[model samples]
Target: MTTALRTDRYELTMLEAALRSGRAGRDCVFEVFGRRLPGGRRYGVLAGTGRVLDAITAFRFGQAELDWLADERVVDDATLAYLADYRFTGQVEGYREGEVYMPGSPLLTVRGTFAEAVLLETVVLSVLNYDSAVATAAARMVSAAEGHPIAEMGSRRTGEHAAVAAARAAYIAGFSATSNLEAGRTWGIPTMGTAAHAFTLLHDSEEEAFRAQVAALGVGTTLLVDTYDVRQGVETAVRVAGPQLGGVRLDSGDLPTLVRETRAQLDALGATGTRITVTSDLDEHAIAALRGTPVDAFGVGTSVVTGAGAPASGFVYKLVARRDGTGADGGAWKPVAKNSVGKRSVGGAKRAERLLRDGVAVAERVVVDDDGDGIPERDAADAARAEGLTARPLTATLMRDGEPDPQWLGPEGVRAARAHCAAAVGELPAAALRLSPGDPALPLVTA
Candidate 1:
């Protein structure tokens, strides 16, 4: 489907004004960055780059969309004509997907004509903000799990399309699987789900339900065992599925005490191998609190999908630089910025690299390039050498002249992102993984 209409009206209005003012074709550079990490988050995970690329590719103003816009009188005929033939033949570079970001880090950069690039602000922020929020939260949850697996099961708690996106983001942040089938089909994330309490309530009794589930899904499937009584449910599940039952889910209860008791009961019943999966509005903090418990895995719903209280990543897309003149060939690039109190943005097109010492990330270096010439890795390395540090380039070419790099587009991209997230988070200091409120793990340095 065309993603053109997934934008704000003001974008088109600005385009119309720029077109009339003869400045629409001026070269421009827009950037995406966050002023601060949300909720005192130590770092933010970058997700949805693939989705943004796909959206940009599909940003077409088809006949239907044009008709709707005309009917609503959203723009003049000239603007509609421009939209009909609109194509973003732009250059996009940004931090690689799964990379951790800090305040003032340039997460994305778009270089194109003013008309072509200005229209992308809404869709870009829409995908990046939400997906990054979920990913950052999921990364924390993964850290809190202490190596235990987490499954995304919040499909019922969010918008239909957002559910799939959340699942993909969660997977990119190291989630083991998802309950959303569409996410599995679209992103190739592993799909996992057993039965809810309704399945147990559907049968005449919990035993019949357990038997039905076992008969259908086999003894290896997890059974929800807290429908009626936690103890009785566990006994019935073990008795019905035998000692080979794969796992039991405790959806409600005091998780720490219940998990311990459940583990002991399973051991006494000779179901010592039965695992205990816990679910019930679990966030990273709750998962961390259960570190000493016998919980085997986590099924995160509301918290992970909703970003555990910080639903938006607070990222903003702004025109950081533009041609110095209104001519088509124009003069040198001029940096632009908003200096509003508490919402100031640094000007100039920027490149970023991580400074590492002894394999641990110490700071993020942002290089402002007023000439619009990007920094090469060799130069970054040379600069880092002067300071007795190693520089790791964080930005990559996401798209060139509107065509996205294939490596960062499909299921393979998600897998690569998961691996990258693991390594990137591993490079941070141990304090970065803490759940307490504190400063960002790495400081930001501007050049």
Candidate 2:
């Protein structure tokens, strides 16, 4: 499957720029830096490792792409030639897929010669932008649900590949399962679903629909109860299928009231074990609203798969460091940088640090240095700085040589990582997690 970049606004020189500059034995480093949506957003989630891998797999240049490169005349023959044989023989470090990151936190760090690190800017963002947005939304949904499981069934509702990736990212962000059949088949994510309204509409009665589903899919099937009326549906469901039915889904109507009253009905009907699941424009906020409800699981759609408030993380991979000049050994140095309004990216090889100020992470900063003294910040800036703490940055060695990673984690492992992130999220101020109109801006320091 040769999946090219879905869109082609990414410049060819992005890769070639680093390579052409780095070939002179000068090292270049790229940092992905950005913040959550304004209004003091608490934090952002790292998303899109799967899509990043896909882009890396499809990062090769085909004839059409090469023609565009040539037509643009973005680089010289030498740089393009270097690209023809290029593979990411570099090191990548950053927040894991589900990690909670603050502003100035390097969501991802790419280190290699100038060329290799720079070439990957666009495709990486394409993956991270959409996926991270969805993941962040999914995380909020999880938090709102208060431990209620979530299902992902937004594939057909979205585009094809978007659906699969959304389901995968949602699972990593703590969704209990997905409803996309192919997502289940492909990623080993547990799939859950029931008869749609169409199934019930196809039958003569809601009772008939429930009975047919229980017969075909078994008594463990979750019955859709709101097609007509939830109380009456549950009553009919119990009469036909007996007690101990699996669950009943509510698609429309006032959910909190419905769950409360439906709970009474099911319990009265001796179907106490039956659970209530709700789905109807359920975003993180709606999930939060249903916290005390009798709802069991939430099927998240538009809000999760499409990033709810801030759709993309706006993570930008920029060359922050390159050779400033020649070294004492005459090997030359690659000093990097990027200075733009509202988008001043760091330059040259960089390292990031998260320092705990009295057991609370009061500050996060990035250190730019060529030869590290184990103190990760810029030496020149320290002299100019009036006050700040020096700490080892947080970018880790994720990929080396050229590979997917030494240990490929499954959805379960990612789920564990998400748990760890959730714990970290607890340490941050409570305001950042709110999905309401106001989110306090979390401050950061990049030295």
Candidate 3:
């Protein structure tokens, strides 16, 4: 489906005004960034870059979209004609998905004509904000789990389509698997889960239910054991599925205490190898509290998909630079910004690099007033060297002249992103994983 109509009315009005004023073809640069991390998070994860490129590729006003706009009188004939044949012949550079970001980090930069670049603000922000929020929260949960596997099972807790996106984001941020089958089919994330409490309750007896599940799904199926008495339920599960029962899920009670007792019971019943998975509104803090518990894995719902306490990433897209009269006036790309109270934004075509000292990331350096391409000038790197640091470029060209770069597409992209996230998180100082509220781990340096 064309994504042209998934925009606000004012966008078209602004385009019409610009077209009439003869500024539609002016060279422009727009940037996406977050002013501050929500909940004082140490870092934010970049996600949905691939999705943004896909949206841009599909952002066309087909005949149906043009027809609706004409019937609604949303624009003049000239504007409608322009919309009918629109393509984002643009340059886009941004952090790859799963990279870590800090406050004031220029996450995405789009360069094209004002009309082409300006029309994409809403959809771009929409995809990045939601996906990054879920990935960031899920990454923290993974870190807190201390290497225990986690399954994204929050599909029922969010909108149907959003659930799929959330699952994909969570997987990129180190989730072991997801319960959303669509996410598995679309993104190639491992799909898990065989039953819920409803499955056990549906049968007249728990034994009957367990036997039927084991018979169909094999003796190696995870059984929901907390529907009634967890102790009795575990006993029945091991009895029906034998000591080789794969796993059991605890959905209620104090997780630490229940997991401890359940593990002992399972061991006593000669089901020592049977794993114990817990899922009761688990979040990062809750997961951290279960450290050293007998729990084998986690099935998280609600918190991860909802981004824990901070749902949206609070990203803002703003005009950063523009050239006058499409180079006809010979005006250079002048920087622009907003100085509004409590909501100011940085201006200029900027390039970002993270400073590394002895293989550890120390600070983020942002260079302003360089060429439109995201490359640091010699002076920027020289200044960092003077400070005994090495510079690592943060942005890559993900799109060029209306086509995807092909490196950030499909299942291979997801796997690469997941690996990058793991490495990025690992490179942070030991304090990066601290759950306490604090400032960003790496300070920002603007040159």
Q: What are the C-alpha RMSDs, in order, of all predicted structures?
A: 1.2, 4.5, 1.3
Q: Compare the candidates by TM-score and give the number of the best one.
A: 1
Task: Give the clash count for model 2.
Answer: 29
Q: State each model's CA lDDT, in order.
A: 0.94, 0.69, 0.90
TM-scores for all candidates?
A: 0.98, 0.84, 0.97
Q: For candidate 1, lDDT tens digit of each residue in 197-281?
A: 8898899999999999999999999999999999999999999999999999999989999999999999999999999999999
Q: Give candidate 1's TM-score.
A: 0.98
lDDT of 3 by residue, 1-447 (tens): 888887888889999999999998988889999999999889888888878888999999999899999999999999999999899998998888899999999899999999999999999998999999999999999999999999999999999989999999999999999999999998899999898778888999999999999999998899999888999999999999989999999998999999999999999999999999999999999999999998899989899999998889999999998885575553676888999999999888887888888878899888876445455566666777898888778878889998988879878888889999998888788788898788999999898
lDDT of 2 by residue, 41-104 (tens): 5666676764575466566766675566678886678766765665777667766666667666
Q: Give the winner by TM-score: 2 or 3.
A: 3
C-alpha RMSD in Å of predicted model 2 compared with the true structure? 4.5
1 or 3, greater by lDDT: 1
Candidate 2 runs further than 4 Å off: 2-10, 13-26, 38-40, 62-81, 324-335, 356-362, 370-393, 408-416, 437-442
Model 2 TM-score on a 0 to 1 scale: 0.84
